[model samples]
Target: MTVRYAANKDVQIAYEVLGDPATGVPLLLIMGLDYQMVWWPDEFCEQLVAAGFAVVRFDNRDTGLSTHFAKGDSYTGNDMVDDALAVLDAVGWSDANVFGGSLGAAIGQALALLHPERVRSLVSVMGTPVTAGTLRTLRYVRFGTVAKLARLPKAATREQEIDNLVTVYRTVASPGYPFPEDWARHVATLSHDRHPRDPGTTVRQNAASRRFTVPALSTLTRPTVVIAGADDPLVRPVAGRDTARQIPGATFVSYPGMGHNLPEELWPDIIERTRAVAR
Candidate 1:
């Protein structure tokens, strides 16, 4: 059965513990920005669990059922790292292999750098260390700039929200695959049920990201595998290449024509390949 553990602040951290806790290695999976733990995909998690790794996947603060901090409250990576550590402690796991996608990958990198002793191994998928003048950074800034210029913040109507969601769906949905409108609506309901997003929390998280850099990449000793989709528009192949190169003994794998989204067709291969890295 899935279990819930309380953070020190009394906020219940919900997690689904999979596989045998004592077999293979403990694997912790972290999701991306504003993404619920559900985004990790049940089949993918099950594949990992079946591969003999004790798997733990949880909701990060303000995303899933985790506690939502104040909108205006400022927080740093230290605070986030603390929350992750606390979750580990509450669950009675000292340390585990870390797998993070996108922002979660960034957090995994930070955890490896900040508390290397706590990480058994690391898999950073579609993540990168901060660097100036990189195409990735420039593209993110350009998108944010355009959003601000277009007055996207003034979107208050539910119609506007739907339009926003549809636009994003069009951009990211796998080609020829049907958009899961029902699933989107279901998730929207869960999002509202959990907690209304505080604009301040997002702002604070952005601030923390801005102030963070992966200088510690050179110091990470954990066995690391950096995975990237060659066609990813948000984070290009070069970014992943650079990240893998910076870390000693890190391996980089590129999937041709694969975009940011994890297509169901690739789940079995992705899961098996990722799990192999743990061995």
Candidate 2:
């Protein structure tokens, strides 16, 4: 079921619940910036469901059907983390396992750090550690393109938008990795159709992350698993290795040939691992 709820920041978060609501342990699945819940892929969610997890997926503020804060409003990535927690509260779930990828993983780290009691376990996929050096190169590469895309006027044509997004996919997406172009185009269209892209917020969020380090990595007490793509160029394996080292009891899993994209092929194993962590 799709739902909307007001957050403390006054943003209306958009979310969808998957699996049998009454079955199994609840798991909150958060996607990256500007990503919708569907990005999690049906098979992945279903695999988790089959593994006895009720999954909740959502679009963050300024993305998908959620409330888009107007340009020029100063906010922090920390606020985005709070937004995740708010979504959990609004959904009426007191505690749940957390799974996130890329930017979503960073937010999940923030949530687990800030609200330890609310997260039972954490699965961070292709995510970076909270250090300036860890992400400096990535921010440099991604910031300019995202800033340009976000500045696009609301009147931009769908074809033009898709073209711009295709370029973005080429850059940010794992090189040599096969992208579901049609699926990505559809997602881009839906994002623009739902809300105007805000250049300022995207820029702000990127900058804010530099100052934000997850100090809780050292103190994270929950069962944790860090998944890194062997060929991921952006968030290199070094980052994931460092993150795992910092978490006292966390385990690290690096795939042999996987790229940053979470292909449907990996869902079964990922779901199995996630279920094991929950157990």
Candidate 3:
């Protein structure tokens, strides 16, 4: 799929679509930190389409083909929300069922809190709640994994970038499931060739996310599904369970041997639960 641009004030958000909106449920797939829309695997998206969804995947600002920002550039979390709304607007979807992964799931939580009407349903995968305080949020993360990530050697070329990405993903990959090195390489290559990622994007996104003032998750009225990986070394499974507990009647499901990565074997389970909530 080719990319399309949505104007959010001055920033141009990049997005792509699969399946027709008229024929299926409107679903926006938001990726996580430092990742682009291409990270949403093609086969995974085709499966979503086959499962009766109009899938729209997008690159957040300062990532992918979206408008870049300079170091020290400051933006409110509302800007991030507007960027998402812009993509939905450009796609002609007034509201959508959102499936967000990791940081993207946090963004979806923020969306649900800030503009509840705009979110039909939410599926949060391997993520913490935006409503959690800084200290609380920190408690859910494993700094050992973070420290290892921080220690990765910097990439100076295209090949180096792809290799680094593969390494990073492998670090958090499912221990019980076979790692899809080939698919990871293909995604890494596309991310590298599609548009070289700006080194500062992660910092900028983290800053913007921190600026968001989220209310209690208990306030959310929409149906939600929280999928946690029991083997996740980053955000602990308890976080998703806690998030589910906060929402009125949110469903919480976890898989053993599933780490931070989403193995293809679990797609059927994830999609079916998400479909139930969206319906």
Superposed Cα deviation of residue 113, candidate 3 (Å): 1.8
Which runs in model 3 stand beyond 4 Å of their true positions? none
Off by over 4 Å in 1: 1-3, 6-12, 130-170, 173-189, 213-215
* Predictions in order: lDDT: 0.68, 0.73, 0.88
Give the TM-score comparing model 2 with the true structure, all chains together. Answer: 0.85
lDDT of 1: 0.68
What's model 2's overall lDDT?
A: 0.73
TM-score versus the correct structure, for each prediction: 0.82, 0.85, 0.97
lDDT of 1 by residue, 55-145 (tens): 8888777656777777566666556666677777866778888898877777888888888888888888876664323444555332542
Cα shift from native, residue 7, model 1 (Å): 1.9
TM-score of 1: 0.82
Ten-residue region with minimum lDDT total, candidate 2: 132-141
Q: How well is each residue in 166-200 modelled by candidate 3, as lDDT tens digits?
A: 98899888887999999999998988897886768
Models ranked on TM-score: 3, 2, 1
Which one wins on TM-score? 3
Q: What lDDT is obtained when candidate 3 is compared to the true structure?
A: 0.88
For 171-253, candidate 2 gives per-residue lDDT tens digits of: 45655456678877776666556664555656656665555545557877889999987766455677678778988889999
Q: Candidate 2: deviation at residue 84, Å?
A: 1.4
